[model samples]
Target: MELKKILCAVDLMDTVNPAVEYAKMLADMSGASVSVIYVISSRSTYENLQVPVEEIAKGMRRIWSRSREDMDAFVAAYFPGVDATGFIYEGKPAEKIVEIAREQDVDMIVMGTHAREGLDRLFFGSVANEVVKSSKCPVMTIRPEKKSE
Candidate 1:
């Protein structure tokens, strides 16, 4: 396939992920531009915050700023010597990822899956699963290799 753009969704929780490498490989082969996206699942309005409005806004800005920093670091660490765009958004991760992919007209999306099961899966929905279901373009999900006992 002739891929012009790719969106790679990464959660900063993990120090490393195989999905990044997969994205890089695909981009290298297809000559596609890669865009890294990280979403902060935070409520838009901090209704519970008793602090002043300015303080609340400032706090939100700080959080976003830190996220941007982390995104930059993640991109640099994962995609050395390669130019990649970074995007940070505040909202549900799956929705935001799909939205960004659509907006950017990406040809494919690459992301890592935690492989949560049973009760954990029920409690915390799978962002990868949701993105695959909702995304307009093809999505590639990489699950980390299981350690041998």
Candidate 2:
């Protein structure tokens, strides 16, 4: 398919190189722009508390800050010709990814998923599953290689 823009949604747990490489290759092949989205979905433990929100927000900022820096450096050095933009969003990951894909008019979306089965999948919802079901455009799910192997 002819892709003008591609949306890549990644989290802290996602492997940086493979996903980025796949995105770059797609962008190059399709002459599309790649936009990387990272969402900070940290939730407050206490529903009603006087705890400082900035405490969590600050940590999120730092996490994203370092992540983005690494992402930028990688993109610039490796994907020289691809136009790359990174975004930070807050809220539920699956919903935010769908929102961004629609908002940005991305033609295709690529994401990575850690094996979520049984209680893990039940307790924590699957972002890739949700996005594939709800997205207007096509979704690509990448399974990372096992670190133990």
Candidate 3:
């Protein structure tokens, strides 16, 4: 397929590098421009509020600022010399990813998964799983490599 644009979903965690690498590889092969998206789930940011609304808002701002820094660092580290645009979104990760992919008209999506299965998958629903199910374009999920001791 002739890929013009590629969307990469990253959580800024252990899976970030592997997912970015996979996306970069695909983009290189297909001559596609890569855009990286990092979603900060509202559930984690706005839940269990024990403080005032202003305090909550302040906390969210701080989180967003930090997330932006992390996203920039991630791109600089893993995608140096590549023109990768980074985006930060607020909401459920899976939904935000799919929305961005569709809005950007990306040819494909590359993301990383923890590879949770069985009861784990049932309890903590996988974002990658959800994206694959809901995405209009093709979704490619990569598993992070295990570190050797």
Candidate 4:
């Protein structure tokens, strides 16, 4: 299919790198503009830093700045010359991804899934599963193969 726009939701973990790669390949094949979204999961604003608001904003900015650079590097290496946008938002990951998909009208929602053990699944939960269940558009999950195991 012709994918004009794609929303790639990343959790900024190593395991999710394959999802980014899969989206890059699809975008390369379909000539789609890629929007890479990373959700901060909305912590309590910030910890008491004993600093000014400007400083806090600057800190947040720095964090996002690094994220942008990292994503840019990955995109450049994989799918060069494709128009790309990276975003950082604070909220529940599944909700933010769905909201961005609705707002941007992306053709596909791409994300990653981890094989969770019993207790990990019990506590941390599955953001990918939630997104798959709730997203307005089609959700594509890429489970990268494990090398050693």
- List the candidates ranked by lDDT, beginning with the highest: 1, 3, 4, 2
User: Residues 52-137, candidate 4, lDDT per residue (tens digit)?
Assistant: 87877777788777777876666566556777787778777888899999999999988887766589878978888899999878
**Full-model lDDT, candidate 2:** 0.77
TM-score each candidate. 0.85, 0.79, 0.88, 0.78
Record all residue pairs in model 2 with backbone atoms less than 3 Å apart, i.e. clashing. none
Question: Model 1, range 1-149, lDDT digits (tens) per residue?
Answer: 68889998887756556589999998888888899988877654474656687887778788888888888888888887665888888887898899999989999999988877789889978999999999889999998785112
Error of 2 at 50 (Å): 8.5
Higher-ranked by lDDT: 2 or 3:
3
- For every candidate structure, what is the RMSD over all alpha carbons to the true structure, in angstroms? 3.2, 3.1, 2.6, 3.7
lDDT of each: 0.83, 0.77, 0.83, 0.78
Candidate 3, residue 112: lDDT: 85
Q: Candidate 3 regions off by >4 Å?
A: 43-45, 49-51, 147-149
Q: Rank the candidates by TM-score, best first.
A: 3, 1, 2, 4
Model 1 bad stretches (over 4 Å): 44-58, 146-149
Write the number of the candidate with greater TM-score, choosing between 2 and 4.
Answer: 2
Q: Which candidate achieves the best TM-score against the true structure?
A: 3
Itemize residue pairs with steric clashes in candidate 1. none
Candidate 2, residues 7-92, lDDT tens digits: the string is 98876444443466778889988889998887777455322356677776666678778877866765577568788887777777
